[model samples]
Target: MEVYVELTYCMNGILFIMTYEMISLLLNINWSFLKILFLSFLSNISIVLIYIDYLPYISFLYWIVLFLFIFKKQFFLYFPVFLIVYFSILFFINTLIKESFIYNGILITPINYKDIVIVVMTCVFLIIETIYLIYAKRKIKPKDDLYDVTLIFNNKIYHLSGFLDSGNHANYLGYPLIFIKKSKIDTYQQLDTLIIDGLKKRKIDIILVDQVLVNKQSLRNVYIGVLDELDYDCLLNKELMGGII
Candidate 1:
């Protein structure tokens, strides 16, 4: 709506000039502006090829909103990284699949402004999706009743509400915090090796390991792993919403 609006033209006598809307779109970009522009152009072409024939009149703003919400926080940081890694991986995979055992190549394609918008939008969408996934993982409040013999898995330590019993006492006369479960540990070798390695330089020799969640449940026949920590200092404290101290 301003007088400073401008335009550009393509080779076919049509005004293929940059518009005010496009300029406004680019205004918010900071450091990775040029790279963003290039990637955006590429994605627009892709969207056209995929949806142009069927969904004839799709608005650019719709894609923008979708991408912005999904990847609001990580858009700038991840977009360039995604572009670089995606192309590199794609090229390597394509070369591996081809008859030629070796392929060293370059990707050179013309940029269309529309493509830039789509790529940026899609990048934002993926970023938001990633955030949502992480949020979900964090939101999972682990239940105490579901576990027995919690473990200090290297850096992260977990607490388990373990059941103590006999038949499951498989410790070879060591300081392993043993527990009883009705199931078996799958790939015991790998788990043992991991626990052993975690305890090699620590204050403990072995661990109190076994399994948890007996049959007729979701976690059936699960072989639990644990290790002894010397300076194993991880604690969780909780307080009421409005309580002090």
Candidate 2:
């Protein structure tokens, strides 16, 4: 007599939403936000790989703290988030790969969940890739002329690029715009209403980026400086953005 049972109804199941918890998971991380997440995810996997014999939960905690130390600033709110994210990853992994090795259906090894592991691993890889993107963005090549450049907004971060013609380096004597390109700007409501006002005042289309996208500089409220000349209907082309007047 043989009994077939599908344990898909267990606490850890195949259906999972990855992005649903991302922002809610990591709260108030500072310095390099994506960088810390990348390092954290990598260190988590590395600990598992090297210490093959250790329990995943225990090893994950060590990696998380190890990363938190490298990232400066303190956000007390992030602690609960850390636990939720860790367990969420663990549960997802446990449900998927828990019974692959122990064939025959009789021994459901909860520890051997592979689906959850694969998903978690992929998420970690994405975080790590983000670090490379952020770092690569910061580096300036010799070819890049610092004087005149168009600010290219992508991935919620600004990449200062293009060339500034020496003859055209006259700084516009007004608040510089925090331009949010059409491709970049997702939700309009996220931006403060002031930018829209600035757009009207400057006789340019209102372009406002999300507050979270910008790093803290001297600017109190990130203002919108719509270039009066550039066609607000489209992103200011590199040629036009490099100069003022």
Candidate 3:
């Protein structure tokens, strides 16, 4: 079977870049796509050189040099860790593709399907790696501004996703205000209209809540109020900000 050299090179370039991104995610090192792509493109040159020389173990040497040059600040041990993840997936996928062909009584030697095999294998592994990374992120504590919370008001329990509002420093005579979406609670005007008016006029409220639970911490006597428009189900009060931030 005749192999298309240029097509193979381009395919390898793309696959290498995708594999690099997966490795970077696994290592918890954030790298921009363009930076990884540029580095991967440069790395593919080693593949061309290896292909020309038909050399074994040359790819490893080239990657070591590239990692050292580009990631001088990172721990050197992570280079081999990344390579192990990248090549293990690549090898498993390529092996499975070859086995599929053989099991079907297809003669691999007579077929010019190497490029197709490489692309398909890379895509499969990339998808698997990405899904795993997403799952891991969900299991880990989120690093964003929002967090899950439980609120107890008038002996009734409610679960909510709370967004931290640094601008919402509104307190009711020293009681922190936790703003809930108006539509979420069935009862309207739970607190006196005078308190609502006081809130709008002076950023103070007469309404108070039993408890607020967030990030394993419980807060007492927080003011619960409702807003017509809010991005989250609940807005965490500034007084209780110490628990999360």
Candidate 4:
């Protein structure tokens, strides 16, 4: 039985990319997906060449050079940790599936087994990475201090979590404003609107909400505009921070 070289290359390439992706996520580093894909494809060339030429020593040299060139020093230091975690998971799964190809009292490996391992390992890494990222963010904010905001609109009240930000110093004709995601309150009929063109002339719509309350302090005639994105449900402007805090 011969190995499927093409399948091996594809599996190795995917695994290489996933390993770095998890590493980047854990470190909270920003890496473009395209760069990761290129690094993965480039690193696996040495492995594919070894499978073809049967020259492990020379192939190892090329692999190391490409790996170090593409990845930073942090990756070099932490990659072994990734390998340990990946192999440990693969071993644990292998125990349950017991999918082994054996010939003459020796355990052989099927090409499909490699594929299954890659899929399983990638999933395990992603789950751990997501949980870690969530924890990393929450660790920075105190749970008890987070403010509860109530939006009164159309005789209907919507409750949301909010944070007072000093950086939100914008105002509309001296009237204080709050920031919320457009998707959260887009249903309400906006009383007024403003369009601002940035350096790239990207037009942004800013809508005004009639009323909002922070923890019991009422903010009447406040503007509620759309943010590019937000981590919280709402952000209270600095003008309202004095009343809320």
Cα lDDT computed for each candidate against the true fold:
0.31, 0.37, 0.63, 0.60
Q: Please list the residue runs of candidate 3 whose C-alpha ends up more than 4 Å from where it truly belongs after superposition.
A: 51-56, 73-75, 97-121, 124-245
Tell me the lDDT of candidate 3: 0.63
The count of residue-pair clashes in candidate 2 stands at 11
Candidate 2 lDDT score relative to the true structure = 0.37
Q: Candidate order by lDDT, highest to lowest? A: 3, 4, 2, 1
lDDT of 3 by residue, 23-114 (tens): 76766755556777787787777655554455566766777788877766463656777667656645554565553221111112222466
Which residue segments of model 2 deviate by more than 4 Å?
1-21, 24-37, 45-61, 72-75, 100-245
TM-score of every model versus the real structure: 0.25, 0.29, 0.44, 0.48
Model 1 scores a TM of: 0.25
Q: Name the lDDT of candidate 4.
A: 0.60
Clashing pairs in 3: none
| Least accurate 10 contiguous residues by lDDT in model 3 | 101-110
- What's every prediction's RMSD, in angstroms? 19.5, 16.3, 14.9, 10.8
Please provide, for model 1 over 1-245, each residue's C-alpha lDDT reduced to its tens digit, 9 standing for 90 to 100. Answer: 11110111111001001111122233432223344434344333333322344543342333344445545655564444444444453354334333212111212222345533533554465456445444554464334423233343333434544432222333333422343221222222323433232312322222333322222122212333333331112111111101211
Q: Give residue 134's lDDT in candidate 2 (0 to 100).
A: 49
Error of 1 at 80 (Å): 24
Error of 4 at 239 (Å): 2.8
Give the Å shift of residue 2 in candidate 3. 1.5
Best by lDDT: 3
